[model samples]
Target: MKNVTFYLDFVSPYAYLAFHALPQALEGCSYRMEYRPIVLGAVFKANAVPSPAQQPAKRDWIRRHTTWLAEQAGLTSFAPAVNHPFSSIPLSRMALACSEDGAINRYVANAVFAHCWEAGGADPLDLQRLEALRAVLHKQWQPTIQSVDDEAIKQRLRANTDAALATGLFGVPSFVVDGELLWGLDALPMLRARLLG
Candidate 1:
């Protein structure tokens, strides 16, 4: 089985939809997925590109399209962040703090994703939301709320972003399989085909 590096940031609505859809999309495929959290803005800046949200038309399209995709995937509870382009650093750092290395497991990543994008969910940085996240993760990972502030966690996110940028990955929901990069929510089918082949 090959390793699929899934680069994600919670701020992207498409990433949220992709996160929920990925398991079924690749069902029975001989692949292992490693979840890597990165700062979306950092990737954009390093690539000298603008965020799709900066364009009015594209932003509207993304919002509409992702909403539809979520419904199609039966993720009825999906909701955009309370604030678009809000600080994902807190959420990213938290995930890294709980990670075994630079890679986060699906369970921890899912909790953070749901906390940031679930319908009626508070801001990911909200203390209550974090407390709720800590409660859930504590059962398995025993994540320390204090570790989010650790310098190492912060650097791990930076390093992950740097590594993704070096790979020419400029967006979230990107998958790197056998060193080949496939990007965007629409790329799932292509990814499945590639993996199956």
Candidate 2:
């Protein structure tokens, strides 16, 4: 089976779109995906660039583009986060807290993504919403909810971010297959071709 490393941050709309599109995009491919949650702001800083959201016009364009992309992909539930460039650190740590090693559980990743994108653009970091999420996750795995604040989980997220940069990945929704880096939701077709070959 082919191995794919999926790097994402919940703040990225492209990541949200790509996450939901992956299943069908490569339907018959034999692959295993390892999800890596990273602090996208760190990546921007390291790359000496500003987030698109920091640019008014580019941010607006992406908001529209991703919305249209979602509709085209038949993702009826997709919605932008109310805070486009909100701190993804807490959610990333929360996700890692539930993870084993550096590979996050797909279920946990999905839950986080849905929390960011599916709640009518609500802020995922809002106390009430986070508490609700904590409650839901508590039922799924008791330890997960409790571990989000652990120092180890926070460090792991940092390590993952460092690792991503070392591997030359600079954006969300990136896929690494056979050591080749592919970025963006638009890379799915190239990823499919790579996987099929």
Candidate 3:
């Protein structure tokens, strides 16, 4: 079986878009999807890359295109939050913790993406919204919340971010298959083709 490791952060609109399209894109492939949560802000800082929303032209283009792509993918319409580049530290850490428990991580990752992108939450930093996601997952929120700042957990987030960078990934929604790197939701078709081939 092929393995596709997906490196993404909860705050990325592109990642949000990819989440909706990926399942269908890889439908016929015998691939395992490994959802890796990383701190986008940390990666941005390390690479000196600005968020798309920070650049006016790119921000406007992403907003328009994201909506169009979502509609095309039959997903609910999406508009990235104004203060996007939201702090993903807590959400990322929680995702890492969930990963330790097996398949729950995928469920939590999907829930977080839906919570932020579909539910129109301002940011994952919003305690109420985070709590709402926890309720949906039927997991205790405080333990996850409290674990975010733990040194070991923080280290894991850093390691994931560094691993992403090492994979030659410059952005979110990157998929890695047998050392092949595919970035962006637009790259999914290519990834599928490669896997199928």
TM-score per candidate: 0.92, 0.94, 0.87
**Cα lDDT of model 1 by residue, 140-186, tens digit:** 45244366778778888988998898889989889999889999988
| Each model's Cα RMSD | 1.9, 1.5, 2.6
- The best candidate by TM-score is 2
Which segments of model 3 are wrong by more than 4 Å? 101-104, 138-146
- Give lDDT tens digits, candidate 3, residues 134-157: 567656333543555666667777
- The full ranking of all candidates by lDDT, starting with the best, is 2, 1, 3
Q: What is the lDDT of residue 2 in candidate 1?
A: 81
lDDT (C-alpha, whole model) for all candidates: 0.84, 0.86, 0.75
**Which ranges of candidate 1 are over 4 A from the true structure?**
140-145
Please state the error at residue 40 of candidate 3 in Å.
Answer: 2.1
How would you encode candidate 2's per-residue C-alpha lDDT over 116-187 as one tens digit per residue? 988888888899998787666664453644567777788788888898898898888899998999999999
Runs of candidate 2 with Cα error greater than 4 angstroms are 139-145
* Steric clashes per prediction: 0, 0, 0
